[model samples]
Target: MKLAIVGGGSTYTPELIDGFARHRSALPLEELVLVDPDPRRLELVGGMARRMLAHAGHPVTLTTTSDVRAGVDGADAVLLQLRVGGQDARSADETWPHEAHCIGQETTGPGGLAKALRTVPVALSIADVVREHARPGAWIVDFTNPVGIVTRALLEAGHRAVGLCNVAIGFQRRFAAALGVPADDVLLGHVGLNHLTWERSAVVGGVDQLPGLLSERLGELAEEVELPAPLLAQLAAVPSYYLRYYYAHDEVLAEQLAAPTRADAVRAIERELLDLYADPRTVTKPEALERRGGAFYSEAAVELLVQMSSSAGSPLDSPAGRPRVVNLRNDGALPFLPDDHVVEVPAVFHDGRFVARDVEEVPVEAQGLVAAVAAYERLALEAAVHGGRERVLSAMRSHPLVLQHERAEKLTDLLLAENARFLPWAR
Candidate 1:
C-alpha cells in the first residue's frame, strides 16, 4: 500500500512515523510519500522519518516532495494534516479572539471560525487533487482543526473522507490506564462534534466506571480536563478540556489573559522538535513532542488508516473491523441533528464503509449546547466556502461565545484583519 501525508514538514510527523514503524502489520506499506510546499522543513522531517524507519528495520520506501499531485499519485490513502497559514496564523487565531473578550482557542469559537475559513478551501482543493490523481477508492483522513467543518466540506463535496481527532483516544487511554485495563478494553460513551464533546460513560469490561472515576479520582480527573470537580459531579459526565471554554468561560478567559497563548508555546516546542529532527543521531520521536499536545494522535491515525485500508476493494477488505471513534455524518445518530451534520462518535466498519454507532446517551443539558454550536458550524462552513464579511459576522454572531452584536462585530473585524494576509482568497 502507498500512503501520503500532505503536511509532512510538521514537527508531529515523527510521532506518526513511530506509529507506522510499530504497527506495520496493521497497515503494511510499500511506499510513504511526504508532501509539503516548504522544502526545508520537509527534508528535516523526512530525514528523521527515514532514520526512524531504518532503526526499526521497517523497509518502507519513503519519498519527500513539494508537488502534491506527484506525491499522492497512486497512493491508497492521503492524510490531510496541513496548516494553511502555519503557526504564525494560529498565533493570530489564538490572540485576536481575546480582543472581543472571548476565549482564545484554535478550535472552539472565533478562532475556530477563522481557522475554518482558511482551512476549508485548502482542504477541498487537496481532496479534489486526491480524487483526480490518487488510487481508486482512496480515503482522505483529515487531522485538521475545526474537524467538523473540514470533514463536512469533504463529505459535502462528495469525497471519500473521514475525520480523526485524538481527544476520544486520549480519553480511552486515560481511562484504561486509570482502571488498570488495556486501552482497547475501554469503551467510551463519547459524543458530540470534533472538539465539542463529553464522555458520559467510560465502560471497562462492560461496567460503567465513569461514576466511580469521577468520585474516587475527582481532583485528578478534574485537574486533567481543567474543569471544576463540582461541575463534573453535577453533570455526571466528563466534558473534554475544550468544554472549559464554555463551562467556565470567565475563568478560562482570565487565564488566557494572564498566560501566554498556546500558539506561542507550540511554536517554541516545534522549534526544539525541529532542531532535534535535524540531528541525524535522533532517530525516534522526541520526548518534548508530548508537551506539544494532540496526545495519542499517531495511534488514532494508525487505527483509522488500518480500517480504511481494509475497506472494500483493498486486499484486506474483509471482516468487520473493531469500533473506533471518528468524525462522520450524523445520519440520525443524534436524532436532533440533520443527517448531513458531522459528529464525533464510535463507528464500526461494515459493508465496506464506516457506520456511526447510535448515540442515545448525551447529557440532557449538553443537547442544547450541541445543537446551538452545530448551528454556528453550519454558518461557519457557509462563510468558509463563500467569503463575505456579512457571512463571517453571521457565523460569529451565532456562536455561543460571541453572540452579542457588539462582540461579534468586533471579533469579525479582528479575525479578518488578523488573518487577511493568510486568508486563501485574500492572497
Candidate 2:
C-alpha cells in the first residue's frame, strides 16, 4: 500500500513514522510519501522517518515532495495534519480571544472558528488534488484542527473521509493503565464532537468500570482532565480537557492571561525537535516529542487506516476489546443533531464503511452544550467555505463561549485582522 501524509514537514511526522514502522503487520506500506511546502522541514523530518523505518527493517520506500499532485498520486490513503499559518497564526488565535474575555484555544471558541476559517479552503483544495490523483477508494484521514468541522467539510464535498483525534484513545490507554490491563482491553463511551466530548463509561471484561473509577479515583481523573472532581461526580462522565474552556471558563481565561500561549510552547518544542531531527545519530523517536502533545495519535491513526483502507476481501475487524473513536457524520448517531453534523464517538468498521457504535446512553447534562456547539459548527463551516465578515460574526456569535453579540462582533474583527494573510476573504 502507498500512504501519503500531507503536512509531512510537521515535527509531529516522526511520531507517525514510528507508528507505521512499529505496526507494519497491521497496515504494511510499500511506499510512504511526505507532502509539504517547507523544503527544510521536509528534509529534516523525512530523514528521521527514513531512519526509523530502516531501524524497524521496514522496506517502505519513503518519498518527500512539495508537489501535492505528484506526492498523493496512487497513494492508498492520505492523512491531513497541516497547519495553514503555522504557530504564528495559532499564537494569534490564542491571543486575540482574551481581548473579548474568551478562552484562547486553537480548537475551541473564537480561536477554533478562526482556525476553521483559515484552514477549510486549503484542506478542501488539497482534497480536490487527492481526489483527482489518489487511488479509487483511498481514505482521507484528517488529523487537522477543528477536526469535526474539517471532516464535515470533506464529507460534505463527497470525499471518502474520516476525522481522527487522539483524545479517545488517550483516555482508553490511561483507563487501561489504571485498570492494570492492556490498552486494547479498555473500551470508552467517548461521545460528542471533536474537542468537545465526554467519557461516559470505561468498560472492561464486559463491565462498565466508570462508576467504580469515579468512586475511587475521581480526583485523579478530574485532575487529569482539568475539571473539578465534584463536577465529574455530578455528571458521572469525564469531559475532555477541552471542556475546561466551557465548564470552568473563568479560571482557564485567568491562567491564559498570565501564562505563555500553548503556541509559544509548541514553537520552542518544534525548534528542539528539528534540531534533534537534524542530527544524524538521532535514529529513534526523541523523548522531547512527548511534550509536543497529540499523545497516542500515531496508534489511533494506524488503527483507523488499517480498518478504513482494508481491501474488500480482508476487512479488518475492530480491535479485540477496544472501539475506535472517529469524527464521522452523525447520521442519527445522536438524534438531536442534524444527520450531516460531524461527531466524535466510538466506531467500528462494518460492511465496507465505518459505523459509529450505538451509544447505549449519553450524558443528558451535555445535550444543550453539544447541540449549541453543533449549531455553531455548521455556521463556522459555512463561513469557512464562503467568505464574508457577517458570516464570520455569525459563527462567532453562535459558539457557546461567544454568545453575546458584542463580544462575537469584536472577536470576528480580531480574528480577521490577525489572520488576514491566510484568509483571502478577509484580505
Candidate 3:
C-alpha cells in the first residue's frame, strides 16, 4: 500500500516511521511519501525516516516533496498531521488564553477555538487536493488537534475520514502494564469528544476490571488523571488528563500561570529532535521524543490503519469484536449528542469503514458535561467554517470554561488579535 503523510516534516514523523518498521508485516507498505511545505525540516525528517526503515530492513520506498498534490497522487491513504502555523502559533494558543483566566491549552477552551479557526481551512484545502488526486475511495486519517471539530468538518464535507488520538491508546497501554496484559487485550470504555473523554471501564477477558482497578490502584489512576483519587472514586470514571482543566480550572490555571507554556517546552524539544534528525548516523527515533508528547501515536495510527484495511476474511478481524477508540460521527453511539456530531468512542472497523459501537446510556454525572462540550464543539465548527467575530465569540461563550459573556468577548478579541497572522479570515 502507498501511504502519504501530509505533514512529514514534523518531529513526530520519525516515531511513525518506527511504527511502520515494526508493523511492516501488517500493512506491507510499498511507498511512503512525506509531504510538507518547509523544505529544510522535510529533508531532515525524511532522511531520518529513510534511515530508520533501512535499519529495520523494511524495504519501503521513501520519498519527500513540497507539493501536496504530487505527494498524495495515487496514494492508498493520506494521513493529516499538519500544524498550520507551527509551534510559534501554538505558543500563542497556549499563552493568550491565560489573560481570560481560562485553561491555556491547545485543544480545549478558547485556545482550541483559535486552533480550529486556523486549521479547518487548511485541512479542507488539503482534502480538496486529496479528493482530486488520491486513489479512489482512499481514506483520510486525521491526527490533528481539535480532532472532533476537524473530523466533523471532514465528514460534513463528504470526505472519508477518521480521527485518531493517542489518549485512548495511552490509557490502554497503562492499564495493560498495570494489569499484566498485552495492550491489545485491554479494552477501554472510552467515551466523549476528543480531548474531552473519560474511561468508564477497563475490560479484560470480557469483564470490566475498573472497579477493582479503582479500589486497588487508586493512587496510580489518580496520578494518571492528575486529579485526586477521591474525585475519581466519586465519579466512578477515570477522566482524560485534559479534564483536569475543567474539574479544577482554577488550580490548572494557577499552575499554568507559574510554568512556561507547553509550547515553549515542546519548541525546545523540537529543536533537539531536529538536530538529532540532521545527524546522518542517527538511524532510530531518539528517547527525548518521548518527552515531546504524542506518546504511542505511531502505534495508534498503525493499528487503526491496519484495522481499516483488514477484511472480514483476514486474521486481523476481531471474532469477539475488539473495538478501537476513534473520533467519528455519533450515529447514535451517543444518543444525547446529534447524530451528525463527532464523538470519540470505541468503534470497530467493518466493511471498510468505522462503525461506532453502541454505548450504554451516558452516566447522569457525566451527561451534562458531555452535552455542554458537544454543544460548544458544534458552534466552534460553524465559526471555523464561516469566519466571523460574532460566531467566534458565540462559540467561546458556549465553552464550559468561558461561559460568561464578558470573558468570552475578551477572549475572542484576544484570540483574533493573537492569531491574525495565521488566520487570513481574521485579518
lDDT digits (tens) for residues 254-335 of candidate 3: 9999999988999999999999999999999999899899999999999888877765343334552458889999998988
Per-residue alpha-carbon lDDT of candidate 1 for residues 1-427, written as tens digits (9 for 90 to 100): 9999999888889989999999998879889999999999998999999999999999999999999999999999999997888888888888888877888888889999999998999999999999999998888999988899999999999999899999999999999999999998887899998889999888876689999998899889899988888988998888999998999999989998999888899989999998999999998889999998878989999988877766544332234455789999998889888999999998876656778763546688898999999999999999999888899999999999889999999998898888887565554
Whichever of 1 and 3 has more TM-score, that candidate is 3
lDDT of each: 0.89, 0.90, 0.90
User: Which runs of model 3 end up more than 4 angstroms from their true locations?
Assistant: 312-321, 358-360
Model 3, C-alpha of 324: deviation from truth (Å): 0.9
In the order shown, what is each candidate's alpha-carbon RMSD?
A: 2.0, 1.5, 1.5
Model 1 lDDT, residue 224, Cα: 92
Least accurate stretch of 10 residues (summed lDDT) in model 2?
Answer: 313-322
- Tens digits of lDDT, candidate 2, 169-272: 99999999898998888878999989989998888888999999999999999999889999999999999999999999999999999999999999999999
By lDDT: ranked, best first? 2, 3, 1
